[model samples]
Target: MTQIAALRVKKPDAPSSAGLLASLRGVSKAYATPAGSFMALQNIDLDIASGRFIAIVGKSGSGKTTLANLLTGIDSATSGSIRIGGVALEQKSEEELTAWRGRNVGVVFQFFQLLPTLTVVENVMLPMDFCRIGQTRDRRPRAMSLLAQLGIAEQADKLPSDLSGGQQQRAAIARALANDPQILVADEPTGNLDSHTTLEVMELFRSLTREGRTVVMVTHERDLGAFFTETVELADGQIVAIHNGEARP
Candidate 1:
C-alpha cells in the first residue's frame, strides 16, 4: 500500500462538478450461469464531468469492466438509468444505441482492434466511414491529424502487423478519436504492453483530458492511478472507495 500512499496527488485546478457529463443511477447487472444468476454490479451511482481522468480499479470480478461496459453501452444493465451528456441510454433500441454510441462515445479496447488488412490511417478513417461523420475528402486529413497527434503519423500507411504493440494501440486510440466524441472509455488499455509502452499510452490518455476529452479507464495497475484526478474503486460489485486528489468541503 506504500505506493498508493505515496501517490497523494493534488488537483488544485479541478473542473466544476455542477455539470455531469455521465451519470449512472441505481445501476445493476446480473448474468445467468450454470450455477445461478450472478450479480456483476449492484446499484452503482457515479457521476463524471468533462475533462476528468477517472481510473476504475478493483480485483478480478469486482465489476470494474462491467462498469466500463455500462458506460460505453457495450453491455446493458439489468436495471437502472444511464445518461451520458444528458442523453438516456435505457430506452434506445439496438440500432439507436449503436448510432448514439458512435456519436457520443469513443471506446478503446484492451487489445488493439485495428483491422489487419488496413493501414493505420485507414483504420482511423473507418469510423468516419461507418458514421458518415464528414466528407470523403475530409476523412483522410482528419485521420492523418489524429495519427499525428498520437505520434504515429509516420506509420500512418503501415499495417497494424508492422507496428509495435504500443504503436498499434496508439493507432487504435486515433481511430477512437475519429468521431471526436466527448467521452473516451478504455478497458485495460495497457494490459498487453511493456512498462515503457504502458507509460507512453497512459501519457496519451492524459493529453486527451487536457484537450477537454473526459477519459474513463479501467486499470488494475495501482501506480497509474497517480495520473488520474480520482480513482473509483469497486469490491463485490459495489463501489467501495473513491480516492480523489481534490478535497471536499
Candidate 2:
C-alpha cells in the first residue's frame, strides 16, 4: 500500500446494506423559467447507506446535478423531504444548512473550483477555516496530510494553475475531505479529465468508501457502473431503475 493509503483509518469490513446515511422521499425541485415554472426534479425517493460508493447516472439534463444538489442542501426542494445522517434538511434555514453542510458533507464539483490565487494546500485548508474544524496551527499539517493521501502533497505550495488536471482534481478531493465529513458528494467529478485520469480519480473515490465514507457521485459514464455499490438511473428527473450492487447469487 502507498504510504498515504497505509495511514488511513481502516474500518472493519462493510456490513450488509443497512444503516441509512441519506434519504429522500417525494423530493422535487422547480425553477422559475421565462416560460413559467420548469420542473428540474420530481418525486425522487432514494436511500443511501454508509460505507458505500454510489453512482447516480443519467443522460445530459437527466437531473443528475439536481439530485446531487438536493443531497448537499444546495437547492431547496419544492416538495418532500431530505434527511442526511438523519437530520431533516428541508426544515433547516439556509444559514443553518450552510453551517451543517460545511461540517457534515464534503462537496466536489467538476470544475475543480480551487481559488486561483490560493496555493494547493491553502485551498484544502479553506474548509477548515470556514468550519473551525481544527486548531489554526494544525490546519496546514492536516491539509498536507490529506494531499499526501491523494498523492499530491508535493504540489502543496503551487497554485492550482500550476498543477495538471489530474493533480488539481486530487487537490480538490483533499479539500472536500478537510472537515472529515462522513459523506462526500461529487457532481461529475471526472467530467473534465482524460480517460486514464478518470479511472485514477474513481479509484481514489472508491478507496474512500473502504475507509467508511459514503460517496455519492453523479456520473454519465455507464461503463463505470460496476465499480459502484449501487447505481441509480434517472430519466427526465425521475428514477427509472435502481441496481443494487452485490455479487450475483
Candidate 3:
C-alpha cells in the first residue's frame, strides 16, 4: 500500500453492504441559450454506495461538472429528484440547501481556493466558523489536528501562497474535512497538479474511502482511473456506461 496519511475522524456507523449513500432519479439539467434550452443532463439515475471512490469521467460538455454540482447541492436540477443521506435536495430552498450542504457535503476544486491572506490553519478553520461547528477557541486546535492528519501540520502557520502546490492542496483537503462531511465532492481536483502530485493526491483520496467516507470526483484523466472503485461514464448529457475501475497490480 502507498504511504498515505490516515484520516482519524470519528466516522458514522457503517451502513449495510447494499446501502446507498446518494441516489438520483430522472435527473435532468438544462440551461437557456439564445438558440434554445441546452440540455446538460437528460433523465439520469445513479446510486452511490457508501465508502466508495466514484469517478465521473467523460469528454468536455458531457455534463460531468453539472452532475457533480447537483450531487453537492451547489446547483439545482431542472427536473427529477436527488437524495443524499436520505435528504431530498430538490425540495430544499436555496438557503436550506446552503445549510444542508455545509453540514453534509465538502467540495474540493481543481485550484486550491485558499484565501491568500489567511494562514493554512486559518483556512481550515473558516468552514467551522461559517458553519458554527465548534467553539471559537477549539476551532484552531481542530484545524491544526486536521492539518496534522493530512501531514501538513508544519505549514499551518504559513499562508497558502507560501506553500507548494501539493501542500496547498493538502490544506484544501484538510479544510474540507474540518466539518466531517459524509461525502467529498471534488471537481477535477488534480487538474492543476503534476503527474507525481496527482498520483499522491489520488492515493490520499483513496485512503479516505478506507476511513468510511464516500468520495465523488469528476475527472477526464483516464490514466488515473485505477484509483476509483467505480466509474460512471457520461456522453452527450447521458450516462454511457457504469463499471468497476480497473484493478491496479
Quote each prediction's TM-score.
0.90, 0.90, 0.91
Candidate 3 residue pairs that clash? none
lDDT of model number 1 = 0.81
Model 3 regions lying over 4 Å from their true place: 1-18, 247-249
Q: Kindly report which residue pairs in candidate 1 clash with one another.
A: none
In model 2, residue pairs whose N, Cα or C atoms come closer than 3 Å (at least 3 residues apart or on different chains), thus clashing, are none
Candidate 2: where is the Cα deviation over 4 Å? 1-18, 246-249
When summed lDDT is taken over every stretch of 10 residues in candidate 2, the lowest stretch is: 1-10
Tens digits of per-residue lDDT for model 2, 149-237:
99989999999999999999999999988988767889989999999999999999988877767678888876677678777778898
- Reference-based TM-score, model 3: 0.91
lDDT of each: 0.81, 0.81, 0.83
Quickly count the clashes in candidate 3: 0
lDDT per residue (tens digit) for residues 143-194 in model 3? 9988888999999999899999989999999888888887888999999999
Superposed on all Cα atoms, model 2 deviates from the true structure by an RMSD in Å of: 5.5
lDDT of 2: 0.81
The alpha-carbon deviation from the true structure for residue 238 of candidate 2, after best TM-score superposition, in angstroms, is: 0.7
> Model 2, residue 127: what's the lDDT?
93
Residue 187 displacement (Å), model 1? 0.3
